[model samples]
Target: MKVQVNSIRAGNVIEYNGKLWVASKVQHISPGKGGAFVAIEAKALREGNKLQERFRSGETIERVHIDERECTYLFKDENGFTFMDKETFEQLVVGADVLDEDQSRWLQDGMEVTVSLYEGTPVGAELPKTVVLAVTEADAVVKGQTASSSYKPAIVEGGIRVMVPPHIGVGTRLVINTEEGTYMERAKD
Candidate 1:
C-alpha cells in the first residue's frame, strides 16, 4: 500500500528498494517558504542498519502490510521465545532480536501479546500498554520523611526498577507505564 509521508508514524513498516524498513522516528515540519515535509528515521529489517530520509508531505511511499495476531507467551529457550496463537493453537518460535529488552521484562507465561507477521514471519512484538506489578525491593521510609518530599527507587517483581512515592514499600502493588517503565501510582485493586 502506498501512503503519503505525512501519514507515517513510528512503528510503521514500509518497503523501499526491495527491502523492508521500520520507521523509528518521524518529524513533520512546515517551512516558511515551502510546502511541509517529513523527516523519517528508519531501520532495515534484514541488517538492522539505520537511515534517515526526507519526503514532501504528500509523497507516496510503499507501506508494508503486516498481520497482527494475538498470542500467549509460552516460554523462552535456546530456540528463543515461543508463543501460541490464541485462536488457532498453532505455535510460533520467534528470535530474540524481534523482542526488545524492555518488552522482555514484562513477558510472563500466558501473558497476551500482539505479534506482527509479515509474509508469515514474525517481525515484531507488542506487549500490554500497562501492567500491574508488585514491588519486591524498596528502601524503607526515613523516620521523619513526609509524603511530599521525594520518591524512592524500587525494584518490581520482574526486576524492572522504577521510582515510587515515599510511602510505598516492598510488597506494595503498583501500576506501571510500559512505554517508559515508570511508576504511575498505587494499584487500586
Candidate 2:
C-alpha cells in the first residue's frame, strides 16, 4: 500500500529500493529554511542491513502489509524463542536472526506478544507497552539526593537496566516502558 512518508512510524515495514525494511525510528523535522521532512532509520528485514533516509512530507512510499497474530511466549532454548499461537495452539520457533535481541530480552514467560508475520513467516514481535518487573538490584540512595528529579540505575528482572526514581530499591515491583526501557512507576500489584 502507498502512504505519505509523513505517516510512517517506527516498526512499519516498507519496501525501499526493492528491499523490505522495517522502520526502527522516525523523526519529523522542520528546519527554518526548508519544508518539513520525515527522517527514518530502517533495518533490512532479511539481511539486517540498516539504512537512514529522509523523505519529503508530500512524497509517498510503499508500505508492506504484515499479518499480526496474538501469541503467548512459551519458552526459549537452543532453537531460539518459542511462541504458541493463541488461536490454533500452533507453536513457532522464531530464530534469533528474525527476532532482534532488544525485542527478545523483554519476553517473559506466558507474556502475550504480537508477532509480525510477512508471507506467513515470523519477522518481529511486539511486547506490551509496559511490563511489571521486580528490581533485582538497585544503587543505594545517597543522603541529600532525595530531589524529585533524581533517578538511579537499577536492574530489573531479566537483567534489564533502567533508571528509576530514587525511592525505588531492590525487591520493588516497577512498571517499565518497554519502548524506551525506562521506569514508569511502582507496580500496584
Model 2 lDDT-worst window of ten: 97-106
User: Could you give candidate 1's per-residue lDDT for residues 1-189 as a string of tens digits?
Assistant: 999878887768999878898787799999999898999998788888888999988899999998989999999998888999999999998788777676788887898998889889887788888889999999988876684668889999878889898999889999898878888889999
Runs of candidate 1 with Cα error greater than 4 angstroms are: 25-41, 52-60, 143-149
* Structural similarity to truth (TM-score) of each candidate: 0.84, 0.93
Question: Backbone collision count in every prediction?
Answer: 0, 0
Q: Candidates' lDDT values, in order? A: 0.87, 0.90
| lDDT tens digits, residue span 63-162, model 2 | 9999988999999999989999999999988888767787787889999998888998887787899999999999998888875588889999999999
**Model 2 — TM-score against the truth?**
0.93
